[model samples]
Target: MSSPTLDDAKRRSTEKLDPERDVETLELAPASEYYVSHPFMRKLLSWGVEARGILPVPREERTDTQYNRIFFIWLSANFNILSFSAGSLGPAVFGLGLRDSCLVILFFNLLASLLPAYLTTWGPRLGLRQMCLSRYSFGFFGVIVPSIFNLASMCGFCILNAILGGQTLASVSGGNLSWSVGIVIVSVVSLFISFCGLKFLSWYERLAWLPVLLVYVVALGIGGKHLINPPPAEPADARTILTFASTIAGFVITYSPLASDFTTYFKPDVPAWKIFWYSYLGLNIPIISVQCLAAAVVVAVPTVPAWSDGYADGNVGGLIQAMLRPAGGFGQFLTVLMALSVTANVAPTLYSFCLSFQVCMPFLAPVPRYVFSVLATAIIVPLSIVGATRFYSTLTDFLGLIGYWASAYAAVVLMEHVIVRKGRFASYDLRYWDSPRKLPTGLAALGACALACALIVPSMDQVWFVGPIAQKTGDIGFELAFAATAVFYVPLRHLELRFRPMV
Candidate 1:
């Protein structure tokens, strides 16, 4: 059956055109195209709010050629203090030294970024948001489960960025400003930028890298003397190393759902390999550089009595403050800039979260995407405040949890592209996106996903619970999840096409 959306027919007509003729354009959708057709709301255009939802972009409207922005999009999103803080977890929490933590960050982060890079190429060809693309594999209804999971992951990312930004803010303010206040400040700015939508976000991200890169370089220079390979605080066992590696993998892999969200307006003729490498390098450069530097600094924390004390008082933020303490007033200035830089991270997560939310509940598609951005900020502020209480534990636990489902979901999509669709561009068939009757029932995809999630339970190792297999093998749940999902999905999909040829 066809979706009851007001523009379904318009979308169906557009899908008949050659997708390649459409080149890059990220203009704001007209206010009348929005779900609520009011006269005054047309003024929203003056405010620059992007009104586009899950609908595929038509060929005629695709007109922008600034394809190079794809690199800056991901680079700015990840190159922030939070990425630095994630690396510090290795030395500060897991007891890994410079050698081990850097190794894990290098290998796993590069490995995890590959899938998201691969998915980026789909945007110019399909003109659909990442989650919208999933309807082909999971059908209309079944796509909600994975979309919901993606929402949770993006929310978790926002919360993490807010808390880190808040911590940095509080650290710079000494005892005057509260962490909660910092969270509200960061959340507010992020919400404002996201409400402005894609054009403004793209412009902001393109330049965000300069300031963040400057601060990181200053931080490295200030702490350069302490970058040493200190002895591990405790023994580094296979389980602990595996868990650390997976956490790093989880951080990069989390971007899979939002991969195509930024590239939907690129010209289809923009070489696919350019999209892939730009995206891959964009993610790799910041994550590896910041995380590795943070790890090295944390490894020397024990040797510096002041830094150790700072870590004791403030966790990640405290450690950062202590390192910058030697620089005095100038350091405080940089700290505040570092705190605000988190908006770079928050903008993309908030923007994509709204899209994913609409994908989950289609009824909300008529509402401006910015309205959901406001709602998401409201939810995130409170959670960020609460999660700040146990920052390290929350970081690890949340990463592990999201990694489980993200890995499984990504595996299914990759398998569908290769085995079922045979890596052909035309196989996506945008007309089928909202038509459930023409789509696969999604029973096989959902079944495979459910089985993968279930089997991974036995291999899960988290602070709240530990599985029998995980106790012996460590937290290899992400690895198990990807493997299990691929194995189950291939056979299940084969049988599905056999029984239901039209699907």
Candidate 2:
């Protein structure tokens, strides 16, 4: 059932004992040389490229201090303008004031950033895709379990991003266009950027965030001038603190699995603290600014409807159009900038997803990342078109479900990084990532994963399924799942280790 890749994966286990046996240490042509040899350029024009895609980035081509630069911009750009308001959702839902909400978000968001930032440290040394790294804990073949979760999660991601982008698109169109049309427009543009591959992605993100940031500043200046006295801050309660903490932590932790996908070009020697602080601050500042604004808008309007697509009391589009209307040409420019924020957010997500597809099905490795991007986009476009309203309507429950599984999975990955790998990463043979005996037994993680799922069900509260325990406990399913996984996995993993050595 296995080929050279299986041999390769098996060889990697023993190869670690002798550094010379590691293949990744060898040199290769520059990334540009490899790029020119491929047909990527032609594909951009007429779509005739038959290039081999998804090559592991070579070490010689790696960046120094710029190791995680693209990721920094990628995260910030994705925040867009609405993200500030969206950050308000949890605080608003639980009735926290602007001051208390900012404090809760600022603290927990930095806390949640820990695991994902830790993951960024693995990218350069391993050069393996994130899912490929799971082979160690889940077994080469057993990796499919998490892969399935990722694929399902990605579906919701594309849909949600499209919905937001559609809103922005519709906003810019002045109601002349349908939201569904905006959805299609954004989906196509996102897929196109994804088709262009990582080189273009890094460049695009570098340029996109500043303009969006500038627009936010302009809006803030105008709005701050007309502000009224705000309501006195509400004192924090246990209920408010716990609910806000879990929700914001859950949201930030969502990036854990996708962390290494963007950092493949970093040199392994990159300082751990450097990666941690850079990624932490990069993600932290943008999200904080966005949420702070969300709070500010609410404090001012007072009547801002209970938060839906930044359009509840004041549609992001309608509000921007009204506020900026006085500035004439400047207003028009700012409106488009706001919409581009949505585009900037959704586009980079497509790249890692394409890599996820390759991990789930290694045979597709040579199929070109662009091919996967287009086909997947096409399949989901129908879902976006037909189910857009359903998804947008139930965003809250949907996010709850997403955060539930995401947090549990993150718990397992964190445990493995600390207890199993011991935080030292070396080169890997990615091709044989599916070899059975060469990987972990898969029993410990899988058994605990199932147990984690069961444990969360009692605490869960969503639109479709609410645990009875949630009624009494106030729906702490996400927090419970996160803790439950760590509890079960630690002991079970120890037991599993006694039965079979991962080596």
* Per-structure clash totals for the candidates: 4, 4
lDDT values for all models: 0.82, 0.64
Model 1 Cα lDDT, one tens digit per residue, 419-496: 888887666666566677777778888999889877799888888888988888888899989999999998898888
Off by over 4 Å in 1: 1-32, 229-235, 498-503
Off by over 4 Å in 2: 1-65, 91-95, 226-228, 232-237, 302-314, 390-393, 426-432, 498-500
Candidate 2: the clashing residue pairs are 5-432, 84-290, 84-291, 311-315
Q: Model 1: clashing residue pairs?
A: 23-267, 24-64, 24-267, 25-64
lDDT of 1: 0.82
**Against the hidden reference, what TM-scores do the models get?**
0.93, 0.84
